[model samples]
Target chain A: MDPQKTGFDYSTFNPSYFQHLEQRIKDLDALGIQADLILFHPYDSWGFARMGQAMDKHYIQYIVARLASYKNIWWSLANEYDLMAQLGQKPLSAWDFIGKTVHQEDPSGHLLSIHNFYDPPVHKGTTKNWFDYTKPWITHLSIQSDNVFFVPKWLDDFQKPIIFDECRYEGNIEFGWGDNSAKGMVDSFYRIVLRGGYATHGETYIDKPNTTRPIWWAHGGILRGESQKRITYLKQLLATNGFNYVNPMAVQGPHWELAVGESPDKQHVFAYIGDNQPEFEIFDFLPKDNIYSAQVIDTWNMTSTKLNERIDKNHYFHIPRKPYQAILLTKIN
Target chain B: MDPQKTGFDYSTFNPSYFQHLEQRIKDLDALGIQADLILFHPYDSWGFARMGQAMDKHYIQYIVARLASYKNIWWSLANEYDLMAQLGQKPLSAWDFIGKTVHQEDPSGHLLSIHNFYDPPVHKGTTKNWFDYTKPWITHLSIQSDNVFFVPKWLDDFQKPIIFDECRYEGNIEFGWGDNSAKGMVDSFYRIVLRGGYATHGETYIDKPNTTRPIWWAHGGILRGESQKRITYLKQLLATNGFNYVNPMAVQGPHWELAVGESPDKQHVFAYIGDNQPEFEIFDFLPKDNIYSAQVIDTWNMTSTKLNERIDKNHYFHIPRKPYQAILLTKIN
Candidate 1:
């Protein structure tokens, strides 16, 4: 926190210090990584101390309004937080303010929200009370392993388009650390899209993930651009799929499966088995005409392959269970 | 990242001392996270090298042998690797090692798998020929999000326990730090369980989390913890009541009506609407015996009323549209 901006050692960064933040926002404008709630100032103890109840609410109002001035940045919100409440914390209250102030300036509200996790939403109905239907709702990127893809259910009921407020990449290589240490990067992506929802990642070291050490960037993999390259494809593929068609349904066979996108109706059927060398078939109950042929969309290279005849209803073509591959069988049309 | 045992070096914890090479893995026992990985012996480079194979059936042999010693660490097998023909990165191979080496050590092979978002298993049934069906499986985890609880679908597939393998928890308050950071810790719990699985998180710091940020635990509110408290609770609840109970069918109604919890039997039902002010009797549905008594598990402490609801098909209860709370209506026991 560059505390000089707010004057108390300025934990606030003026529109000055890093041209990167502004440029990145512009690039996001170009790439459409636009959602709301981008945090510039992290936990500023000084700012928090001086502002008190007025501290963040006033600062967030300043931050969001300033960012709102530029179309490049649409999300205007703060931590509106509550993860650690012991510090006389008041992020959520500020969110109440954000909910009120943001819409007053931008009707569509620029897809904004605050960041939170470890803690579920304390202020749920506030957004609906303040912003109109067009305004997006804010929510955290649920990170617990058991909470895999839990946000969709939260958002489904939230009655608003949720921007995954904060999703961190973490990996702990036993021996404690080093190479292959961070997690929450690509794996978190799998959880996000199971229900055809969207979420964002807060890269630990934004500009250069490598600048960090054994744990942050870890291994020479960063040199290989391992995390970056894979995530780009995932983001594009999920975004391209158009969430509507990817509804959640239970698909069980010799093994467990969760699938999105129905076979014929949506012009395609996509099935994903989360784990196991699930021995099963492609078409167990086909209505004949709905079968257009099965193709495995290998996400790694975006590889597309058409299957031969073993994939029929009676045969139960063996699906050599692999992780997160999108199998789509188009309508014969 | 163990600054003490990381085997790496830092320029007094500043940018100039960014660590590039690891010291050495003299004894495999001291290899994990105990010793620093950056303190490369200025006089020697290859002194600290992990045994990874680009060339033989015994490829993962060395590391496997070490882990077989039964250390108490969650291990992941390969890093984010894909066999790409177009990029001349094809001729890829890895299965033999994981099957023989990793599997032998951890019967629950998922503890080790590739870290990826879009990448599928290239090692599944390849010619190096090391995969079999104790479960022919692949593990998936999305280290994509900044949210600690959010996991990608790739890791959600484990019909059994699955480690998030790679998650990022820097405890950096770039957004609003502190307890807000706990959201990642809390969300990470439910995210994995709802997917019918168990999970893990990755943290980044110079020392053991407990040692450094003694309070920064990855629990209901921090980046460090003895166990994922809330995550365990949520997962236990879902597992106890079939995961399918939380399926999301559709949102139909005047308020924000939506359904979640999915099971093959479709016996369990969860529904929520955002009209907290609605005036409907709890059991407006007559002949409540026809349907299961709805039990709303206060997973997120949203309610403390207790599980005491009598039911009938005519149940018309007023519920608020919220997150982390689910209502289960099952056939009466």
Candidate 2:
């Protein structure tokens, strides 16, 4: 527990910490939430972040052995692992050893990944500072980039489920990584989800002087952002439509202006117009022979209106000329 | 002017074409506007784009001799010169020759430049396909990118005047490059101008079947978009304030989230909260020793409201918590 120690004393380790973690995992599992446990982080004043490789390996093995049996557990090896490496607390080989140890120790074969910090100078659009996601022990990619439009390329480059775990939170905090507006957050989610990836949400609203409420991103408390409900509506929309897999239609003509996606069977199509507010769009990208029922979705207001006119390749559909609008088309016959 | 011909006969070259260009240049000069004449383009079937080096040199010489006498004329050697190179109509060496020819032939020495087509695969953040802006003959940059956020980087890299001449037009056309909403266009202008660059505006709303109207971007017509007034307002604001040179405050703390800029003398500071609707921002970035008057500008509404409270490093300035709002601070003492 000393701040200057370089090794963990196993005999003096508290058992109550493991018990609290288990109880929290059980509670999250009951609520149908996956416990994405971050085992290492650089934002520490204690000596845990500076522990040498041997003690770090022992810590990872202990946690994986005790927690991997739960059905809803995702192992995040570290939050901002690159930052830790930059500070000389750990090296790339240390991360590799820790990852391999977790992969071998976990009996349940849970999802294992490492989150990264996006330092623009070193990690701008390139994976120069990222942990090797192509390693067999890593299950998926937990990225920290604000450019959600690049998700399609990342998905193509590494054939794994990509989760933008930190695309800048939805709040009014001063930091750049924590002060995106609600509309910005919703747009990022739609952009990523429509391109067959996932986005995580966080908030960092500074509380008033009298109120002692914790910021949602640092210490979990009551949710105070407007993006949560819209995100839930998006989730329900995807689940109801049975769109398990949607890929961006980059080769199609309209994809350049709109975030257009299509299901594998070519029956469901959706396009998210993020900031462009065109009054009307010609639906020439639709199939020529198939008839489709069109619906306009106001992502911000969480409203869906079915258009009276059925759409085909020849028809032009009029829109409300507003931002944060989407169109969903389902094959009718 | 024949579509199939590869050579130009000087005897048959129309004198009226030169006269018409001179008249147009005079008209634009009367309005205090610069005529950015594009000498060559690839969107042609007239074989002008594929003209050999000899004819190309002759054409450049003729235009520069006839047009460079006007003070308002800016020599854009070619529009989308990279696309011309990609299509094998002109290589880089040919463009260099054309630019050098224009530089040498123009007796009046008008501003000379070349515009580029942004093919994402080849020119994403890297200047691989861009014309060598470092050449002595080139005076400024005319870019075709929608990412106005990268203007600051381009300004640093090239150290030349940057103009996003084709950051997508404000319209409802079918083409991606010709269809951005009015709000989108205004936002692009603000982002670029705030970062000490310039942006050009265009409109491309498709007309009804019965009405035969030309697209503004293709053939000059009546103005229709809402962005023109806001851009004019921004121009007046800058002109009245005498901010001839403003640089981005990237090293400051709040610049990561807000588009903050300062005049070279640091007597004027402006921040554009483009899409972020923060309720209140702590004015800790301001100098503690100076007293300043603050104003909130509704960029889209073209309205400015002066605040009752003065600002310094100690005060927290509250905002309207809406999109497209800006804060302007002027040191009074």
Candidate 3:
């Protein structure tokens, strides 16, 4: 009942408010952002088919479904729905209904998937029934794990490729922020890929409403906006030329010791990781040994660009680190 | 308004309810663990401290302070206050006020903490802050790690030994209710302590609200009411003889190939952290290999349990383990 509190509020409605949605869609059309990931939270929208009393919440839910019907929108039923539901919390049902409504509304094709905090169970004999195949359905998860649970648990069974909505929790070279915890990220990347899968190592963030929190935006400092570091790093990396996603099979590994990103042709690329010994985990996942160039991106400055020159399996890297740093390697065809 | 449908109803309040508070305190003490965490919606009890009701909803605060006045009842304040404030969805005043008022009420020693979906920041300077030892406080966190924030960050630095107020996020393991997910609890116990700090790894049940989860009651399915395996294992290895904690400094160089526990008198009591080659980092931390006995109890379990059969470290240990479990070793003082 307390609007400023953290549970579901009954007022974020007003379906007639769709009056502005048309213009908002047109505005997004000009931005060229490609797609809007609309994470649907119906219960939060105050719309419940079960709630027969208030027409306001119901109307608001309708407007939400209608707006998401516009082009350039990908519908993630709800952000981390599995986690929420498992915790015995209620979310909006409008997601499944929204997907159906979006198709009936526009029909050009609307992407649908549940934005889960981890690999959602591909229900018994219902993997296909769970998501829209028009676009990839990715579940957000952490790549900062010692074991590669994403691929086997979710991706391997999916008909469409699964993108790791959130593979890394912290990324960046700044202090205060979690930029200092990259070791786990670098390790998890290869572990996921080498086991055969795709994941987006994106960071997530939250901010306050009116005032501002340093790391996040709001005074309460909860998740609200886009995670800055991973987004920036991703957009830049994807923009680079001659770089492509690597293959899991390409790496010769008994147990992948590195994270590698190779070209589509497997001709030009590089893989590496960081550990106590300036050594990288690359060889653990690679098949070929006749190496190209080897470099160590100082964790302190990932943008500096340096190389360890030629290296082999017999050697342990000599680069010494005081902690809170990493080693990056680059290679070309 | 719709209590059955699950939202808290607020229209039922009567101001005269507070005049009889002395009895509420008596009841709480008598019916302690029998009750759920008293849900403190401060705005519900006391209204109009009036910081512009326009900005927040902190009315039920008096109730919390009043309840804390009684001994033996544990409680969680408004579920997720941060998210509520953001949507203009809830009363900001409750949080704003409770943040200040709870201290005034619980000054005589009571457990306190917020149940954030993820880990929230510890208020920097508090008279009864978790770090300052002003009081024994707990952070309400989970085990499955929903899309919220990370849990380890809070557990590692939390001052009063931490407790996983809600550890059921991992209820469904490996996509099913019983797919070897129980291993997760074990792995989590190791991960929490080895990587960071102490955790009272208990869980909640829709079936048994009053009873502790299996981990706490069963001890990895061993005892009927406690986790003997967990406690005994940790005590022997990490909290050697209860005099001191196992330290990270015991590991000599990079390999982190070893881990150790020593007596306050500077004698090695345990060391088994390495690969097949046995890179015990405790070499330097050991006290001149003084005569001692290394007793490997249940060495068959990969999580082998061994003990320092004596009071010194002059002995060598050859611990054989089962296929998949943790191996524990102890040096006799």
* TM-score of every candidate: 0.40, 0.93, 0.38
Candidate 3 C-alpha lDDT tens digits along A159-197 = 444555555344221111222134445444444553445
Better of 1 and 2 by DockQ: 2
TM-score (chain B) for candidate 2 is 0.91
Candidate 1, residues A131-208, lDDT tens digits: the string is: 232333532232212234434454465545444434433222211011121222444455455554455443322222
Clash count (model 2, backbone only): 0
lDDT at A137 for candidate 3?
A: 29
Per-model CA lDDT versus the true structure: 0.39, 0.79, 0.38
Can you tell me which runs of candidate 3 are displaced by over 4 Å?
A1-16, A19-39, A42-71, A83-106, A117-149, A152-154, A166-238, A249-256, A275-291, A304-333, B1-333
Alpha carbon lDDT of residue A163, candidate 1? 43
Error of 1 at A44 (Å): 1.6
Worst 10 residues of 1 chain B by lDDT: B118-127
Query: How accurate locally is residue A315 in candidate 3, as Cα lDDT from 0 to 100?
Result: 35
In model 3, what is the error at residue A57, expressed in angstroms? 14
In terms of DockQ, the best-performing candidate is 2
Least accurate 10 contiguous residues by lDDT in model 2 chain B:
B248-257
Q: What is the C-alpha lDDT profile of model 2 across A1-333, one tens digit per residue?
A: 344563546435567989998998999899889989998888876778777777777788778878888999999999999888778777767788888899999988999999998854335546787888999999999999876666667777899989999888888755667779988999999888887788888887875422376677657767889999999999888877767777766533334567777777788888888777566677676667988898999999999999787888776767776778898889999
Per-residue lDDT tens digits for candidate 2, residues B249-291, read 5533334567767777788888788777666666666666988
